[model samples]
Target: MSPTDILRLLLKNWKLLLAVPLALGGSLFYFTRHEAKSYASETTIYTGIASGYSLTGNSESDYFRTSNAFDNLLSLIKSRETKEQAACYLLASHLQLKELDATQLSWASLSRMRALLPAALRRQLTGPTLAATQRNVTAYASANDTNELYRLLNSHDPVYSVEALGKVNATRINSSDLIKLELETEDAAICRATLALTTQVFLAEYRSLRMSQTAAVIRYYEVESEKALKRLNDAEEKFLVFNRDNNIINYYEQTKYIAGEREYLYSDINKIEMQYAGALASLAAVDKKLAGRGASLLSSAELLRQRKHLESLNTEIANQQLFARQQETDAAPRTQQLQVQAAETVLAIRTTLNDHYAQLNSVEGIPSKGLLDEWVKNMLEATENKAKLEVMGRRKGEFMAEYHKMAPLGAMLKRIEREIDLTQKTYFALFTSLNDSKASQQNNELTTNLKIVAPPFLPSQDKGGKRLMLVAGGAFGGFFFVAATLLGMGLLDKSLRMPAVAQAQTGLPVLGLLPAHPTHPFKKTKKPAQASKLRDHSYEHAAAEHLARQVLRRVSAVPARPFVAGVLSPLRQEGKTTVVQSLAHSCNAGGLPTLALYPEGTDAGPANDYTRYYSPAQATLHRWNLAELTQPRAADVQLVLIEFPALLEATYPVTLFPELSLVLLTLKASRSWKPTDQQAVADLRAATAAPVEIVLCGVARYDSTDLIIPIEKSKTA
Candidate 1:
């Protein structure tokens, strides 16, 4: 079929196609309104390190290495711990636990508990059907008792699903970082509360874990202080034992030993004391020193000499303290080393002192022996006690040196210790607080990390009420459906829908078109009103007639005469007779002399219906019995259009219309001309021995131009 024909068909059946989408869309829109409204609430979570420390070195570097803050936060949102908390919160607040308990009570007992027991029991129970015993009981009730209870017992009952608004339903949505949470409860306040509570608990739990690292640091310092204190005590005890072993007391023996063993140390101390006296003397000697030779004595080199002398004196004092320790342990290595070294050097000096003493003793003529011994004993005992005191005094000096060192470090140590102690206490206290917080928070709930950016709210108005969607969708679907239907119709249609196909089928020059009318042929009218009718009473019926008459009017240009136009079809029932009648009617109506020669072999020919108009239509209607054509009856007639059926019996009767212009007739979208029908038209035209112009009949309404092809215009002679 031509595309226009296909479009026309779609236009014709548009309503049916439109009906499907309209019905479906309307039903959908209507049902959607009745659907229950859903509400949603959400909370956001931000997980992070709560520790505020920014320490340096290995400790600071290692802190972030093992911590998986991002991953742990992700896990926290999906954890069953969170879900269980959520479930418990929802169940306690929204679920129908109380109603469940109510349901557990026996129905009979519940009915009996109320004063309306018998009446309630009758309503709760449904009478059975299809049982003889039950039917008998029902019949007895109907006959004997006509009360409300009787009716209730007999009536078939319906059980309704409880309308509990507190049921909770959880739904998770599509974001990985966020959860689209929803609870099914009628109360909007409850939904918001549930979400809020869940979030609070989760934060409590999350913050407790946040400070764990800081708590660990505080605990470590407490452990180190105990170890340092123990080490200090052990060192002090060993030092005390060494002091007791040596019989040493004061610094006097230490000073004597210092003077005898190192003479330069004593010489240096005497020189320092002398310089103090000299500096006083130099108070008046500056003017004398101002002279060239005296200036040399006050030069930097001279000052260095004096400073070295003063440093030697301080060294001598330090040696005196060491000497006291050695006096008690004279036989010990510390003492023996000092004595051996000093004795070797001082032996020469002692020999000289002894010679001087021996000379004195000789001059005194040898004192008594016990008096010398007693004097030596007194000196030795006094020296021993002095050495013991010196030993004690040196130890005290050592302690004082250590105290000086410790004094500076002591403040630092105490500060560190205090910090360590404070940190330890904070660690324990914070840990304990965390535990307490966790226990309380275990019952408390918090929102998950995922939160809905936009919670579902009760809309003030539904988006378009779905009606506009219904209409638009209906229109779109209907358009496609109609297009598809027309496409299918075009493919399956075997009848010639285009004028070209009709020409190809029968070798006819398509002359005209006739539209199909939905109205009866007699009831048709003009115009937009014409779209409603089943049949065309005016234009369509006259179309074929007008086409034939126009062909006859052009016969002078034809190459042959006794022109014959045959309205024909491949099938017997194709509307060929109707075309023939319409053709004859137009010619007759136009005042053209026309005779519809009805050949007798087939009752299906168009002239059979026109028999009443001709006086000799009945007698000469048989095959080879055209008495009117042979008679002198048509000399004045300008043209004649014949009705010849495509029959085998009529194929040989061509002599009556010799030198004839043969025109073949067909209807648009009607039965196509078969091969035999085509051959019959060709044989009749060829047998007439004439040039024939085939005429197509009844092309579709839009294709009148295609029905006729214009011949070339003649030039002026």
Candidate 2:
């Protein structure tokens, strides 16, 4: 279609385009109304940290920590633990969980309580599973965020989802500043109990954590002190042993005595050695003389030599005796010298060994104050007997120093022991007192430091929004659906709706345009048999005749004298016959002498002389040859409407009628009637004996109105 044509079509069908989406939206709204209404009431809770307990000096850290801490607590409230706790609390008060368990519980049973709870309750608790269908899924309220308390309350059951224990359905309603805790059950009292129990549990948990923290600090310090005391005791024991066994005491004196003893023992032995040597010399001389006397008596050769040796030995023996006599004299210088030398050697050795003797004579020589071995033995004996008074006295002094230093530890140990005893006593007392206080608090229903700022109120109607939003949501959904449908239709459309699109494919000028009828001609109907038959006849007769009237009118309006109008399109079934008849009638209506002609087919076929409506007064309608038109006719018709079917024969131009005002060809909009189809019409125009104008017929309509038309009855009848 041309841009003008497209714009016209859009303008005409604007309501249809909009209605599709609107209807979808309406349907969505209608269906959503069946869903249950959820209402919420919220009470604002300002959780504050007390003055003395905070460390950041009124900073938001306390609030931040509280928010974090409460997040876990809030989760715990909606947890199965909280559910069981709530159920137990309710049970304790003679209220039953049978109703709640039946409606709100999941279908899965807890393995821990499956055996304990009744079989009916087991069915109430369901294991989480994927939804079989998309619609069966339920939404969840976030357990971490505590800004809304109603989420906690509503989240306990799918009938409602909550933000917190005391706040429920706040997101679904107005007046959001308040944390509304909604109880969705039919019972009002149960809702109140659930809220109250949740608050009490939160307080209990907070206090328990506080006490544990304080006790942990004290226990950590006590353990560290115990380890320190153990190390200190070990150090003191080591120091005591080191001081008593001082290895360096009297060391120099004992070394000196040892040096003196070594010299005396070695030097005294040299003096006696010289006296023994002299005695040995005198005995040698006497033995030699006795042997020589035996030798002198023998006169043989052996005896003569022996006598000579004996004589010499007797003389030496006398000299040795004299010498021995001199050496034996105490006053003899040599003997005196020897004695003195011995004495001097002994003295020198003693001098060399002086330090050794001093060591021997030192106090270490004393039994009580001896070397290490002796002292150790003695100390051991003394300790066993408790008899060495001096050793005991020194020991007492050493022990006293250590004892004094360690005395504090002993006192501390005793103190810690006392503290432990006291703590044990206090622990018992505190435990008893705490139990009593707890009992009293429970009995009195005392308000804890953690107070509930706002109690859950019974909703008048409901604090949440109603089903209108669902309707709006459905409307939005419907709008998208319609848009999707239109976009899909546009995308899938392959038929040529625009002339430019066809021209782009094949560069052919659109010679003429046949707008779609105000009403669509081809559509199924639910009319009665008579009405259908009437409608069919009207289309065949009146509608066909109308086309012939338009054809004649177009031919006369051409700029050239006696202009020929050709009705043509891309394919068949585009009402060329109808256009031709309509044009003829239009010419006749205008009081012009007109003739309707059908082109002759080759070989004298049915196209050569096809009969149209017979008329006695007006011009006869007949198939005429191209050769026959060039020749003169019986009368000079001012207007001639030619009806030509699209033919693809090569000899079609030769068969074209002569003196043709215009070549009129017709084809359907569907099929392969592209720009090439226009070439067929252009082919006839080129072969015409005269100038030719092309006219298109049978455009399809987008609506029913475009295809309907009024019927015209024949006046000649």
Q: Report the number of the highest-TM-score candidate.
A: 2
Error of 1 at 362 (Å): 55
**Which candidate tops lDDT?**
1
Which tens-of-lDDT digit does each residue in 523-602 have in candidate 1? 23566455523222344544544465566666656644444564444444445455555555566556765555544553
**Per-residue accuracy of model 2 over 1-717 as CA lDDT, tens digit each:** 345544555555567657765776677667765664343333334334322222223434455554554555445545644443444343233212333352222233222233433555334332233221111111111224442222333355422233323232222123221123345543344445555555555456655654555455545545655555555555555444443454322333433433443343234223323433443444343333333332222223543343344333333333333345423444355435544543454344333333223223223233211332232233223222222232233434544564454435444444544555555554555555555544544422321245456765544454344456665666566556655555565556554444433334434433333444412332335775765567445534344434545454555576544444444434445555555555654456557656555444312112212212222112123443533443443244566555544455322233435556555554333334455666765665566655443343444433212322435323333
Q: What is the lDDT of residue 258 in candidate 1?
A: 41
Predicted structure 1, TM vs. truth: 0.42
